[model samples]
Target: MSANADRDDRDLEADPASSTSGPVGVPVDAVCVGCGRTRVTRTSLEAMEIDPRVDLSDLDAADCTSFKHVCRSCWAITWRNPIAILTGLLESERGE
Candidate 1:
């Protein structure tokens, strides 16, 4: 009945995946696809010893490389060979 409650209802309906607790509904801290390292929100990317120079645009909306979650190390490696990775993703989408 209240405005806040109405908003909550709308949000729940809009995103069925939302949750009040845990990693299921929230943005995860940075994850390294290369080493399978999961960083929580408290740790800075630099503190994780991740490369700051790596461009993260190749990572898709889900914060993944080629739609697959990768760590900073793996991202660094993949970034070095962008053409191959992009071509592979495109090819995969084409079922080639």
Candidate 2:
């Protein structure tokens, strides 16, 4: 009957797909259409070292650019393009 318990119940009801005990499942900032994870981005997808033909086709480019949710788990597992990472790092270093 406490306020905290009431909130917990509400939270549970709000998102049935979320795991009760696992990685901190932050609410989807951007849902990835590929794996249905709430954590993906076009840039992140592009940075993945997948065959451009296979991977790019899987991307929901319209949604990603519109600032929607995506699959963080997929992104996490995908091999990242080192050149992209290095370029990003260099860009930051240069304050570009």
Model 2 ranges off by over 4 Å: 17-96
Q: What tens digits encode model 2's per-residue C-alpha lDDT throughout 34-71?
A: 56544322343323323333322243333222333333
Overall lDDT per candidate, in order of appearance: 0.37, 0.37
Scored by Cα lDDT, where does model 2 land? Answer: 0.37
- Looking at candidate 2, what is the lDDT of residue 8? 97
**Candidate of highest TM-score:** 1
**Any residue pairs clashing in model 2, and if so which?**
30-69, 30-70, 31-69, 31-70, 32-70, 32-71, 39-70, 39-72, 40-70
- The stretch of ten residues in a row with the least summed lDDT in candidate 2 is 20-29
Alpha-carbon RMSD of each model: 12.1, 14.8
